[model samples]
Target: MKIIVLTSWLILSVSIAFSNAYMPLKDTELESIASQFPPLEYLNPLDDGGLLQPFLIVRIPGTENSTKVQNHVNDFFIKQISQGQNSSSSEIPMWKVTHDSFQDSTPIGDNITFTNICVSRDPELAINEGDKARTRKRLTLAAHYDSKLYPEGFIGAIDSAVPCAILMYVAKVIDKALTRKQAFLNENGVGNENNQLGLQILFLDGEEAFHEWTSTDSIYGARHLAARMENEDIENVDGLIGSGLSSIDTFVLLDLLGAANPRIPSYFSETHDLYNSMRSIQKRGRNIKGLFQHKRRESNFFSSPSVSENVHFLGGTLGDDHTPFWQRGVPVLHLIPNKFPPQWHHLTDDVDHLDLRTVHDWAIIIAAFTAEYLELTNFILDQ
Candidate 1:
């Protein structure tokens, strides 16, 4: 995790917009999304083939371990999700995988290459010639895939390992729902309305600083990608000219998660309502039986709106991967805890220190949140 500082300039300078009302998923819809797959299927530490186990290593930038982890993410999206799907066939939904690789000088006086793996399932991305869907909005979910350089063997389980695995799980669960929705629309001979939002999952590299935290050293991948996307133009299908950055509805960055009894506070006032939506999702999960196996002795994972509202004026937002995007006018929902975990940046931050119950519950909460955000409830229920 990058060092957090309370900068008043950052709070006053970034753009703010009124958040729209989020439609709360019904109880049955919540249950259906939660039960679509086992919450622990990808997060289980004992399962070698699962997403979590492969990330339990020291993956510093430009290292062999980092390449291995990057390949794992690529394989899941390319081979697993987009394996048999024919691009010519609109009935089958496919994920578009792209890599943003660049090299820069580090604080250690060495230049190394870093790659950001981006996988997206845009409903309107590529269909038949006449049936091409125009990409409108995307709910971008992101997390860093690199560990700190100081610790020789730091696994960074809670630092970001578990958060990366959680994203993979979310993508896998939502892919099925998306496939069904596309198939249903195709069968009914109905086009996807302009309101349908796309899902993009980013596995960023070089989030950690080589030596100490600084403006240039930390968040290497985010700074590079944000600048690149700002200028890169997407192929216009509906005569709409927009950069990749403009298409993002919201950028949700998860960090320092997977610890037991974490208190995640809402930082920006603009996205507080979106934060409340997540809080509402977490509250609604309690109503579904067996959704949360182990209850935290402390407060819920999300701090109450009443309590978090005060944090807006305190300038308590952390300097993280979202900083670059937020500076570029992106509405960011930073989901890191107010207080860093005790095991943060320590050798004990390995897999043994992770809480299975907290890990499992977070997977469900985030999965449910994504389902509602993408409006997958109607399609998932149809399945």
Candidate 2:
């Protein structure tokens, strides 16, 4: 009789604990994670004529200098996993580079090639009847590391440097979190293992236009890669997520970050739900100093969040790296400031003018949105 009573109490305790622990993400927590990125000094180019030396995602076939730059970016993500403090180091991801060539009527040539960089962790194969079964879904986080050209100089810190740096740290934090989770499961030997979705980071190339934004001009790398992925024979491929073009669950793109109270207006008709979900996540995090402490406040998910309705966007639409994927009907979440910063596209945009708080806020929003999408709130709580 005593054993039965104890078992019932234990089960009830476990249920209650799980329920109580699943809390929404906090700003302070995300800020700490965002701090993992190096300071502004390391984010920009050498502040000379060197921008074109390496940032020429515009030139035909790209350049070895830019490839070296791409590799330099990849090295940061790799280093965090290899030398991360207070996190498991096993199962570090590798960057998958695919050199894509496309036809371009440029002054230099017609056939232009650009290299795309991808980093992702393969999901553990499902066990079913002594054979591999379904593979877990994938969530992609993308940012264009390559910048447009300028006659004088285009460091483009706000143009893309902020987003790229934020993603670098986001990858680092998520990698550490995932490794820690795997280690936890290893030690405890408990819980359903396949309850998580895999993460894929895509740092695209050739996002900016060599000349102007045309149906065929901008997003050269994105266009080629998306078309290529769509054409691949999925049947022959093993672990192609779930579907070929449909393998990706959501492709969230970040741009024009690191400004004070930046506006993020929704554009795409399909991404309304996803955008709302993200907005709700941001709303929940900005409630108060300690709103989460009160159980009552937790219910108010989106109470008076940040907004700047007076600010206008570019034709109520945006042309960015996600255009190619969105053309294929892939769900895209475009996180760009509604009011494009004053220093946009000009030489004035640099690390000295960027706002760290806004950058930190962006990191928080992106990470929190991803965690919610993957249903990892409990994971946050568990930690």
Which has the greatest TM-score?
A: 1
- Per-model lDDT: 0.78, 0.54
Off by over 4 Å in 2: 1-61, 84-107, 126-135, 183-196, 235-243, 287-316, 378-383
C-alpha RMSD of candidate 2: 13.2
lDDT of 1 by residue, 58-134 (tens): 89888899999998998898888545556565656588889988999998766798999998887743334463655
lDDT (0-100) at residue 214 of candidate 1?
86
lDDT against true structure, model 1 = 0.78
What are the TM-scores, per candidate, against the unseen true structure?
Answer: 0.90, 0.71
Deviation from native of the Cα of residue 310 in model 1, angstroms? 4.3
Error of 1 at 286 (Å): 0.6
Best by lDDT: 1
Q: Which stretch of 10 consecutive residues in model 2 shows the poorest summed lDDT? A: 11-20
